[model samples]
Target: MTDKAKQYLELFLVFFKLGAFTFGGGYAMIPLIRNEVVSKRNWVEDEEFMEMLALAQSAPGPISLNTALFIGNKRMGFKGGLVSGIALIIPSFVIILIIAMFLVKFKENAVVERVFKGIRPAVVALIAAPLYMLGKSANVNKKNIWIPIVVVALVAFLSVSPIYIIIGSIVLGLLHFLYIKKIHKR
Candidate 1:
């Protein structure tokens, strides 16, 4: 096969494997994404991967799928994005389709219910692991650490909508940029 075709197939297979095996959800997939894209394939630098993770989280849709699209588009443009995204979702789609067909009948099974119960804490840890790594990469030092703490508090305790937090962060970043620009002009 041609080089381009090889690249597309690589993308598809990589994401297919991730989607097929990962248990929890999008957030839980972050570490696997980092392993594949940043370490294994060398598609993006560590900082770029972290930035993509942030963008994927802030934007609508699943983080895993968004990361796939962003990385694919960055590497090979629109076709790459489409292929990567479709491949990433295909396994999950198939699995869910099968599950949906039989889920109702198994919903009352004690073993199945217990399995889900055990998965919950594991999923939480999987999600939190990436958050900690991303936070450190984003420079969450003591000086600015309060920002994330406050946001988490708001969402967890106060039940604030994440939309407001995202918007507020954007506004804050823009204002900071302007402030620095004004200071430089003085």
Candidate 2:
């Protein structure tokens, strides 16, 4: 096979393995993705990976697929993005399809319900683990630490919609940008 073909296949296989083995969902897959893309393949530097992760989280859709698309595009352009996304989704699609086929029948089963209930807390922990890592990488120090804390409190306690938070963050970023530009002029 040609080098380009090999690269595509490698991308497919790596994401495929991640899709197949990972549990709990997109957030849970972050570390595994870091392991493969940052450590194993050396496709992106740690800083770049963190940036991609942030972008992926902010984008609309699954974080895992978004991360794959961003990294793939960065590495090999549009086709790479498409291939990585499809590969990452294929395994989950198949698994969900199979589950859907049986889920209706087993919906009322006590044992199945218990199994799902048990999985919920672990999924929460999986999601939290990535959040903690991302927060650290984001330089959430004493000066800016309260930003996330406030966001989390609003979402968790006050039941604020995340869309507002995203918009507020965007506005804050713009203000910061303008402030920096003004400083440079002065």
Candidate 3:
């Protein structure tokens, strides 16, 4: 195979490993992805990784797939994107397929129900871990810290829809942007 082909294959294999091992979706996969791609392979720098992450979040499709595509493209161009995207998703596809088949056959079993019940709390904890990590990484300033506090308070006390929180964040972001622009113009 050509050098580019080999590179693409490597991308596929690396991402296949990441996808197979990571649980609890994209955010959970991030630190692992950073370790592998940035720390181990030296494929991208930390700042670049963060930028790709931001782009991945803003793009269409799953965050993992978007991340894989961006990194792969950076490494080996279009073919790398194809290989990495497929690799990132394939594990979940196969695993879910197998689980679906098994669930269809044995969902009513007491042992399976018990196992699922045990897994549920662990899954929630896994999801929360990434949120905690992101909060630390974001380094919220005094001005922005209240955004999360108000959102949490509203969600906890008032039971507001999450969409309101999202909209509020957007509004706050816009106001911050305008303020910064005004300050720069002065």
Candidate 4:
């Protein structure tokens, strides 16, 4: 295979594994994805991953799939995106199909329930791992710590829509930029 073809294959395999093995959806996969894409593949640096992750989180879709598209596009353009997306979906699609077929049989199985119960704590850890890592990566300091805490409270306690949160953040960011520019010009 040509270098480009090899790269595409690698993208397919990597994303396929991520999709297949990751149990708690995209957020839970962040740590593993970071390790593979940043630490192992050297495809992007930590800062770039944080940026892509921000963009991915903002967009509608699984963060993992969106991230895969970004990495694949960075490496090989449109074809890369297509390859990565399809590869990522295949395992999920197949697994879902198999589950749907067998779900009735396993619906009340004690062993299956116990297995899922056992995985819950691990999944929570997986989801929480990225929060600490991303917070450090994003340079979240004591000064800004209240921002995330407030957002979480709004979402969790007030039941505010995330769409509004996104819009509000955009406005705040623009205002901050303008303030910085004004200060710079003075």
Candidate 5:
């Protein structure tokens, strides 16, 4: 195969490993993905990963699939995205199929029940860790900091739908851009 093809294959393999090991879902995979793709391989930079994550969130489908597609495309091209997306999904699909069969066959097993119980808290912690990291990485300052707080309050207090949250964030982001533009003009 060509160098580009090799790169795409590597992307697929890495993500396949990630998909196989990750118990939870997209949120739990973020930190592990970052560690492997960003820190270990240097395939993507931290800022690029964050930006890609934002794009992935706005796009359709699962975040992990989107993430693999984004990074793979960034590295190799369209072919990379196709290969990586397929690779990331295949393991999860197979695992799920196996688990479904096993669950049907052994629904009453105490061992299986206890294993799932043990995994729940670890999955929660894994999800929480990335949230903490993302918060720490955010460029918080007096001017723009309140935007998140307000958005959170509106969501929590008013029970706003997530679509509204996306709309609100977009408007706020544009306003922040304008504010900075005005500051630069002055």
Candidate 6:
């Protein structure tokens, strides 16, 4: 095989492993993706990975797939994006297909119910671990720590839609950037 073909194969396998193993969705996959792309394979630097994550979250898709596409495009091109995305979904599609085939039959089984109950805490932990890591990556610190807390509260308690929160954050971020630029000019 040519070098490009081999590289594509490697990308497919890496994302396949990620999709097959990660639980609790994309958020839970963050750290693993970080480790793979940044630390292990040296595909992207830490800062670039974080930036890809930000864009991935902002886009209207599963963060994991979005991030994978970003990485693939960065590495190869549009075709790379297609390859990575298909690879990412294949394992998940197969698993979910299998589960759906028997879900109605097993949905009320005591053993299955207990298994799901036990998995809930594990899933939560999986999700939370990435939050802490991503917080650090995003440079969340004492002065800015309240931002996420407030956003979470607003969404969780007030029942505010996240679209508004995202829009508001974009405006605020641009305003902050302009303000800093003005100060730097002076």
Is candidate 4 or 6 superior in TM-score?
A: 6
Model 2 bad stretches (over 4 Å)? 1-7, 24-61, 74-76, 117-135, 141-146, 180-186
Inter-residue clash pairs, candidate 4 = none
Candidate 1 TM-score over all chains jointly: 0.67
Candidate RMSDs in Å, in order, are 4.2, 4.0, 3.6, 4.5, 4.9, 4.0
- Reference-based TM-score of each model: 0.67, 0.68, 0.71, 0.65, 0.60, 0.69
Best by TM-score: 3
Query: Best candidate per lDDT, number?
Result: 6
Candidate lDDT (C-alpha), each:
0.89, 0.90, 0.87, 0.90, 0.84, 0.91
2 or 3, which is superior by TM-score? 3
In model 4, which range of ten residues has the least summed lDDT?
123-132
- Writing each residue's lDDT as its tens digit, candidate 2 over 1-186 gives 999999999988988998899987786799999999999989999998998788898888888889989978987899999999999889989989999999998979999899989999998887677876788878888999999999989999999999999899999989999999999999
lDDT per residue as tens, model 4, 96-148: 89999999889689999899899999988977777988899878999999889
Give the winner by TM-score: 3 or 4: 3
Q: Which runs in model 6 stand beyond 4 Å of their true positions? A: 1-14, 21-63, 74-76, 129-134
lDDT of 1 at 186: 100
- How many residue pairs clash per model? 0, 0, 0, 0, 0, 0
Candidate 1: tens digits of C-alpha lDDT, residues 1-186 = 999999999988888888889877786789998999899989999998898888998788888889989988988899999988998899989988999999988978999999989998998887677877888877899899999989989999999999999889999999999999999999
Worst 10-residue lDDT window, candidate 2: 126-135
Q: Quick one: ranking by TM-score, best first?
A: 3, 6, 2, 1, 4, 5
> By summed lDDT, which 10 consecutive residues of candidate 5 come out lowest?
127-136
